[model samples]
Target chain A: MSLRIPSVLVSLVALGALAATPLAAEPKSRFKVGWSIYVGWMPWGYAADTGIVDRWAEKYGIAIEVTQFNDYIESINQYTAGAYDAVTLTNMDGLSIPAAGGVDTTAVIVGDFSAGNDAVILKDSTSLAEIAGRNVNLVEFSVSHYLLARALDSVGLSERDVRVINTADPDMAAAFQTRDVTAMVTWNPIVSEIAAMPGANLVFDSSDIPGEIIDLMVANTAVLADNPDFGKALAGIWYETAALMVADTPEGAAARAAMGAASGTDQAGYEAQLAATRLFADPAEAVAFTLSPDLGTTMDHIRTFLFDKGLLGAGAPSADVIGIELPGGAVMGDPANVKFRFDATYMQLAADGAL
Target chain B: MRLINRHPGRAARLFLGSLPFLILVVAYLVASAARLADNPGDKLLPALSSFAQAIETMALTPDRRTGAYLLWSDTWASLTRLWAGLGIATAITLVMGLAIGVLPVMRALLAPVVAFASMVPPLALLPILFIALGLGETSKIALIVIGVTPFLIRDLSLAAAALPREMIVKAETLSASTWLIALRVVLPQVMPRLLDSLRLQLGPAFLFLIAAEAISADSGLGYRIFLVRRYLSMDIIFPYVAWITLLAVAMDLGLGGLRRLMFPWWGLEGRR
Candidate 1:
């Protein structure tokens, strides 16, 4: 009763091979964009659920797929890996990961920046300098880590002065409850939760760095170049949604409430997160911010931090490994290897009623 | 030649055993090729060359920032925690399991409590452990011990209780003291079963270890996997997962070999 299993396996393999042949073709009209849970990027989910994304994409005769990722790093990773055409990421991550990974990316939309959203709290102390010689828990290599470095710099100290324990974001809130974790750097919701605990004091926040920690909607440079309509539609969708979210009307409040619910928080919690987030409500203002001289200065700090942290890729002789092209014909780092292009043309068009 | 002739279908049996693995590899390759053909930058089903490159970077090369080989260091850190947790659990289970299995009074007092405690998911107790034990090696190690100890106790107790009543009667007939009988008669029989129970608990132990490390730790196989997951670096992740599988397989094989070598009679009966 010996069965000839090999023949059956071979036929199955042949069938799979035949099925795989047509999957190599690309989908020209479809584009995927990934977003993670955050105060600024919550509008993306709202736009997708409310049919706003489809409406804008329909105007351009294209389809947009909005994907949400629970993990913040995964969104940027998918974008870098070409699984998504665009992603929502912070300015520092945009410079460190995708651009450093040799993916040409464009900052199409400056969504918002964390003002007081990301913060550092102490168990009993009231000052940043008091953080020295204490175990500071944070998600290492995240925006919170960058924020901690800047906080330490402000106090005439360095990372060497304190020991950082790499605690996951979900655990940071409860980890702070422990007596050993005297200090912690984390983002909103968790930061708010920990701050409410007895004896916890907010000592530092992203407000000190102002617009340094910029949140953005960045697209693959090659994809945007091939289909400029995608960028135009995305920018239109973002500005429209941003306008709706900030408006004092009932429609706007309802929109914000939907975004809040999508982000796993209630309206009040979402509103608190939004209050700490400085939204660039106006496209003109966003364009101005992109073209401002402050961007270059902020990028310089970001590039320096990323390079120092060895996030600029191995064998990076200097911070000049990945070049960034600003809006005003300015290039930071090596122009020969420019990967991050800050093009404000789409935002400008949106502002001038041309899009 | 005699052994080969005796087992005429040995080669065929070996090939049949490996067919499933061969099919899995082929399927993965076909799927990966299709993805790479569509998008060469696909990280989920990365090409084998990319895995080689990733391995060279993470395993061979020293990290520019930390100045350590990440794979080896992570393995060492995880192995240390795992061994420490298992070692403590084994000691506690051996002592308590023997008493509860042989002494009816001890079993009545502790068996139900152990059963109830095991029902509560260990992950739920992670925060409590961190708060009580602090965010150090102690909490992580305690998580593994707490997760696997109850199952080990239960299994060892059952094995001990299932031992022949005639052996105990004979020992008592020979005027054997309780301590001497427990040690000379029971411990020898229980040692092999303890190893068997430990082998069964390894999967759960690894689960508890990874959960703890993923929640909080600077370095561990689990920590590294979760960390690199953010980058969607599947190349690195694939190799790390393969390495963990290899380590677990080796540990299981080693325990099986030890069981055979130390308790041939018990091993023979178990095989039967």
Candidate 2:
């Protein structure tokens, strides 16, 4: 008996067509927010765990789910794939992963930046200039690589002067103890651990280059545009928890300790990580930072590094490929094809007690 | 005859072997084309032309950063680790397998321990290895060795122990010492089995090598795939995966050819 191949092909084509057909316009009922472990982004987990997220979401008449991902990159990828309405990621990654992948994304919350959180450590050395002629172990192509590039440039050196061994983040701590590992670049907790070891010294860190490695909660641009309540709900949840986490009170300490324990650290350890991070807990400050000219220059440097590394879309001709829209309608890159935007509207609302 | 056991002639064998792979490639091309037609900038499934362009840049072009071709360097780094791991594991297993196979005392001491160790997942021990071995090449090579050595020892020892008792007795009757029996009689008989065990292990060895490299290496096939994975550069990733698979197949073929050439009497019944 011969199977009807033409009929089968027609059925497959029909299924594809059905998938392509858009649904009738309706108000979205549910939203998902993706987050991973980071000192600044920990408030997302805390809000979700303590029903703070649920309260805000109910007020906005929407169901919001907060999901935690183990791998940081995977969470961004999922967000780019439209699996989540919002995802907590760094600014460069928000640009590189989703915006670069052709997904329209907007930073709803400018949470924080690494102050002294990420660092370069050298064995028996006290200066960044001594890092030359050494093998630096770090996760290649990560924010650490960006930090290393900036570190090297400051010392009037380049990557050619040293070797970059692409060690995994998990291995960075252990790799530092080995005799061959004279120099390395990595972020908090590991930096804390390795710096305590004998003969290890912090040469340079993110504190020198503030506002560059920014953490953000970016949402799908279309989702925020259609459901402004989602934006309001997200901002309210963040600032409420941020207030609790930052207050010098017993309740605040309990809130912070819970966040710390959730992220595999204690209250003191988490507070140390928080110290290294410049968390914009005050709504007005975060909005001010978003509107600052420093944000513009920071993005300019990041785009240059990303474009040079081919992190921007492959077809990109120059650093001006993806247009990043800042506050006050000022545009960066090809303005006609803008995909990434920094909107502090909801943050302003939170600051004015209007949410 | 059952359809499963039906024999195919040479021409038929070639066509039959390639049919499934051909179908898979065609399906992928169609799916990729459909996705691209919808969104030309899709990185999840890049077009065929983009793959060609990616390979040209990776293989033919010298990298602007370090002035080295990435593909060749990655292959060299990964293969060097693989060979070192496989070589050390083979040497250690040969010595230990012979001991455990011939002497009950050695068997009682090691066999149970090895069998238990193999049950423990090698991936779980990865963090400990990095900590104890200090995240250099020593740890990577050690992972590959630890992952494969237990099985190799078990297989080779079984082959040695199953040898006919008459062979050892005849050698003993000729006033041969225990060392002489082990060297002349047992060693020669077990050589072909060692080749067979090594051939079967090529896949798992590559797996462990890639895992180790992914965790900690500056240059390797796995490292390149994973590093670019952060940017969702599937164009580079697809080609690298195919290249690694080709290298593995070549190594498997080379091992089979060596076995046939070195021991003419081995697997003489068929090339199965």
- State in Å the error of residue B247, model 1: 2.5
Write candidate 1's Cα lDDT for B29-86 as tens digits: 8877875675454555667888888899888999865789999999999999999999
Candidates' chain B TM-scores in the order shown:
0.93, 0.94
Please compute DockQ, using alpha carbons, for every candidate against the native two-chain complex.
0.34, 0.30
Clash pairs (backbone) in predicted model 1: none
What would the DockQ be for model 2?
0.30
Give per-model TM-scores: 0.87, 0.91
Instruction: Give candidate 1's error at residue A243 in angstroms.
Output: 1.2
Worst 10 residues of 1 chain B by lDDT: B35-44
lDDT (0-100) at residue A226 of candidate 2? 86
For candidate 2, write residues A225-278 as lDDT tens digits.
Answer: 888999999999999999999999999999989988987889999999999999
Give candidate 1 regions above 4 Å deviation: A1-27, A328-330, A334-337, B1-69, B269-272
* Candidate 2 chain B, run of 10 with poorest lDDT: B263-272
Error (Å) of candidate 2 at residue B137 is: 1.9
